[model samples]
Target chain A: MMRGLAVASTLIVVLIALALFMRSKPILALKPLTTLLFSTAWHPSRGEFGFLAFIAGTLWVTLVASFIAIPVCILASIYLSEYADKRLREWIGPFIDILAGIPSVVYGMWGVLVIVPLVKNIIAPLFGGYSAGYSVLAGGLVLAVMISPVIIHISVEVLRTVPSDLKQASLALGATKWETIKFVVMKRAMPGMIAASVLGLSRAFGETIAVMMVVGNVARIPRTVFDPAYPLPALIANNYGEMLSIPLYDSGLLFAALLLLLVVIYFNVVSKMILSGSKWSLYYNG
Target chain B: MDKKNNIHVRRLEENIFKSLMVFSTGAIVLALALILWTVIRKGLPHLSLGMLTQAPKSGYYLGKDGGILNAILGSLYLTGGAALLAILVSLPVVLYLNVYLKKGSPLAYIARFSFDILWGIPSIVYGAFGFTIMLLFGVKSSLLGGMIAVTFLIFPIMSRSMDEVVRMVPGELMDASYALGATKLETAFKVVVRQALPGISTAVLISFGRGIGDAASLIFTAGFTDSLPTSLLAPAATLPLAIFFQFGTPMPEVQGRAYASALTLTLIILVISVAARLLTRKFTKHVV
Candidate 1:
């Protein structure tokens, strides 16, 4: 078992580092890294370096998308885990799981043909926006729908794990269902919920194909949700082939990938803090 | 008396809200059903036997000339290959975590951290990683690279789920087996796995479902080849890739083909999901 654990842990990090290092060597040559990562000029074929535009675009969509999804997922999870009947829980649980498994490419396809049109013609007008099919609003909205299931699944499971005795005692004292859930159940499950939400947030942040198809793949400052923008993932995939024209361009793209990778790893570490039941003790110590 | 009547009114309203909430619990099902219906409505008309046999040549893409023969075969190979690779990589890690790591050991903590990190990384990032790793060995975009990327993507999920099966092995059973002079490995392999077979099987099925639906990460790693793959290193296209590439074309016939492919992909994913749920329910009943 010790040997196995050693192999597992050591291998993952090595694989991760090797995987990044082999692709354009961002750490080995840090001299140009600053200019590559921060410059807003994104002309790849000409060897110019910049990722500020992609970084801004990615954060913009993620913020808008998370804003739309987080509240709804929290409420829905509470309803299913604490309040729903066995029959309702039976179908809803698996349905959400299955929804999460749907490929990002499928969502992209739906976005191009269906969601793009809907946003362009219907949602845009309501929000006082333009009707460009592939715009920031379309991308963020699709991402929210794509990732909402992850948020719901993880949050609901954590809520369900709250102690039954606590819930029963509250109810036995004549506390109403909503009151019991609002105060007692939520408090007990708070840490786990935060962990699960962090997990969801990371999952949403890392999602690639779904957002790429709809994000309009243009390199620019995202001043408007209606404006077209390019994210790191989309930029990597879309321009990597075209970037073959210049090695520095390829290297710049690698740095962008590294940035995205670090962001994901950061979320992973945060998720662990939530998962190992560490925060409860850390709080008391602090 | 007026206060009492107002309280009564409020109680009635709460009851109505509670009942409504209970029924709204089916909202997920309704939402999925609606989405599926919309996709099918738009997608099914584009599907036919032609999609499985003939290859699209140009703008018209009509008649028997509109099949994703390469994609159909390529998707199966990549999906099947990736699923197999993930199951193999995860099984050992999960087994170790379940069997050897003490409940409070730092090794166990690190093991979990590894799984969390592996799961957290996005598919696109994995694709980029896979490309770089393979590129060093002089491998180009190919089915092998795609499979490797997806393996990384799904390995953590299956490992986590499989560990649940491991943790389910009754501690008493392990103790009893050890008390009989069995080695820990023998006991874990022989007894624990046997007892947790059903759960492990469910994990495999879930991983397969996830593997089939994966698309974005595979795109750059697995360049779409219209011909059936002759070697693992050869570029190949899956259904999702076909849908992505073909959908962008202005041709109605090609677009229809893309929709048809989507229909096929959805049906496959939905079937595995429902099957997994039913199988899990059966396992619970048997356990009781």
Candidate 2:
């Protein structure tokens, strides 16, 4: 019975991929892959269905979020694992969990109330630009905050796996604390940190409701961070309900879902490979 | 003099980097505080007992009479059903990984990798997949469909967390059970399950919190309704979607209700987190 259940468990991913592909075959058959992927037009009423703008928007937001999140998370995790005492680390644990636990809709609401205005009136203007507050910057800011906990939690675990004796050896060789961390601990933990960041990127890439709320869903390529953009997840979420009315519109949205699934799977598989191939897993599993 | 100057420069760099790290951590904590404060300050005025008890009345979206009792109950029902379904699948899968499979079994490793990948798949994709299944089966967007979608979303979360705890169960304990003439199945059910109970409960609660708070997976699976669902086939309202719809309205009053809804969701999640922590602490005394 257990063996049967385990086999069934492994089949779910295959089934989901197959199901999505079958459902989206109509649109795939209608248009060449390049036109569907590279064309800029998205007028479903007129039978146009290009996904380039949404893809670009997804990449842009994920990139902006990575810029904001990666440094802060790495620093914070380093501090927690290296500098903070046990009591402080224990206290911070629940805080990170709470941050992760807060519903995405709540984050969206907060973004609308606070971050949007700050970007509109203060940060954007300081840079000699104007924004309505609902822009790629707003979406990226919210997403950065949303994915921080994931990166921090994983990176901290990775840092902790770097044996203390290695650090001691560096210090015993007359290295300063910062130098030991930079040369020894970070060198040891690099693969794990990369894995953590990749995981965070995947999480940010497929976020839907929060980004949808703040991202002022325009389907054009954004020229600047302050411009509105539409992302793949948001596109699927906003249009799936109404797509049944148009020809192959439902297929188009399902195709978007399929694309998201494939990308996320690639990221996860790569991170898994990194984690398993590194010496960190040997230390971690042992 | 040259050695002293070098030491001074190194000290300055260390201090600067340390301060930056501290500031980054502080900024994250401050963002959390600001999010909670914004929700409370805006939602507290509009939150009332009626909002928890009564359904929305006519013109409710226009800032009129009534509350969001339907959504609260609907969220509770949907999460409860999904949690039950997920636990059924997750527990068996987790047990098989820890108890049935060999330590270095390739199948176990593949199963875990798949779960991790599934966990990373966005809720919106699950929503779309659920919609596809519904189309194939001629099932409309209803409570049953929502439960099915959420089950898929949380299965990996529940299974993987439970696996973490169960894998920690010592081999010596299982050996003891076998030496006493117990079968592997008996040992698993009686010994390993008892040891991992605390972690299993925490996993269930955490996944429950996630299912309750998610909006993307339910947007297409559970069609929104003003009234409470009367059957498994009936449409249901959820707190996250309620907040989404209300906040999208043009009126400030409706927008205020959205804040209140957000506050309600946040509080529920907070309670679940605290409960998980406390339960883990309380139940850990029995473990060796």
Candidate 3:
């Protein structure tokens, strides 16, 4: 039974690879694969299948989201691990977990009802841009909210590992609590914190439905955050339903899935190595 | 020479930073409250008993739905089937990792690493993978396909969580079992499983919550249907998709139903999370 379960668990990976290989057989030509990666125009109807635009859009949104999420996560981690009393910590901890539990689709719904309008009616007009509301900025903001909990949870764990004695040593030298955190805790937890952020980045990279509902799924390279854009996951999702309509269309979408899987694998492996190097295990060390 | 002044400045900075940290922590709570409030406020008015009991009407997307009975039943069926499949597969793998393989074995290490990596793969990717497999098998979207996709999505999570639990079973207990002439298999199934039941159930509940709330993964594999699913091969409706479809429609009544659906989904998740907590507490009392 045990071996059978192990085989079953591993089978999923094998099946995914096999499925991708089978699906891409029709468009295995080198010419199309290169065009699929490098072409700028994404009009599948005219047989134009460049993916650079979506790649750019995905990167841009992820970068913007990281900028927004990292600071809040670090601050919240420091507050939770170092400053909050036991009572306060107990109250706050569950909310953070609950934040993580909220479904992505609900986040998208919130984005549709809240964030998008805030971007459209408030933020956009201030920047002299039209508030179509479903722009890259709107998507990035939603992604930021979605990923902050992940970053906070990991970062809190990393911060908690900083030996309490170190803080006392600083305090014993007449340093204030914040001074100890700033000079001692942050420096010691830096690597693990960086790993936490990377994990969050990888998560944002693959998030689909929430980003889709807000990102204004135009298959063009966005010149500004206010402009509409498309990410790779959204592309696969929006087009998958219609993929069978055109020649090589199904294969094209499958290739995108393959690319996503490969990229995510690379990111996760790198993250694991980084965390291990920092002596941080995702599970409890005991 | 200005050492006294430097100390004073540092103290002031510390005070400012502490306040900032408090504010940021407060924001997390505020955010959660805001999300729940918005969902309830917008979703409450359209939430009716009929909405829960009936299927969507012909013009349901136009805000004239029967209740979301089809989606509710479909989600239940999909989550139930998928959760059952994942537990059966994961329980053995977890036991083997802890009992069959020696600690620090490279094979066990690699298996753990693989599941960790699998845990990070996104739902959309799973959907795409499922769609590809379905195409290869000449199968149409159906309840079975949706369960298969969700099974893949939750398998890694369930295994990893259970692995953590089983790993926590004290080594002394297993040794005592061996001393009593119990075989490794017997000790594993009889001893470790009883000890790890609470954690295992918690893992299953968490996965069920995940499977039920997911929309992207099931969208490709479970084609939507207005009628309730009667067989494994039948296409199914799910609350997440129903909410998505309803909210996207260009009608006020339909959009209102979207919130009601969102509320329903939230309430279900809330109940599951609470139940998981209660089960963990109850089972921990039994852990000897």
Model 3: per-residue Cα lDDT over B1-288, one tens digit each: 586559778888878888888888787667777888999999999899999999877977665648899999999999899999999889889999899999998778878888888888889889988887777687789998898899999888888888878998999999999999999999999999999999888889888888888888988999899998898988999888888888888898888988999999988987787787778888888787
Give candidate 2's TM-score. 0.97
- Give the TM-score (0 to 1) of chain B in model 3: 0.96
| Maximum-lDDT candidate | 2
Q: Find the number of clashing residue pairs for candidate 3.
A: 4
Q: Give the TM-score of each candidate.
A: 0.89, 0.97, 0.96
lDDT (C-alpha, whole model) for all candidates: 0.73, 0.89, 0.84
Question: Candidate 3: lDDT of B156?
Answer: 87
Order of the predicted models by TM-score, top scorer first: 2, 3, 1
**Candidate 3 off by > 4 Å:** A28-34, A277-280, A283-286, B3-5
Name the better of 2 and 3 by DockQ.
2
Tens digit of per-residue lDDT, candidate 1, span B1-288: 686347566567657656655544455455456567767998878777867786554533442375887887888888889888887767666767777777877776666667667767887777777777776778888999888888877777777777777877778888899999998788878887788777777777777777777776786688887677778988987888887777777777677777788888888777877777677678766651
Give the worst 10-residue stretch by lDDT in candidate 3 chain A: A277-286
Q: lDDT tens digits, residues A97-214, model 1?
A: 7776666777777677667888778987888978687888778777777777877777776776688999999989876777687679889877777776676667767677778888
lDDT by residue (tens digit), candidate 2, A164-228: 99999999998888888899999999999999999899999999999999989999999899998
Query: What count of clashes does model 2 give?
Result: 0
- When 1 and 3 are scored with DockQ, the better candidate is 3
Judged by whole-model lDDT over C-alpha atoms, candidate 3 comes out at 0.84
Docking class of 3: medium
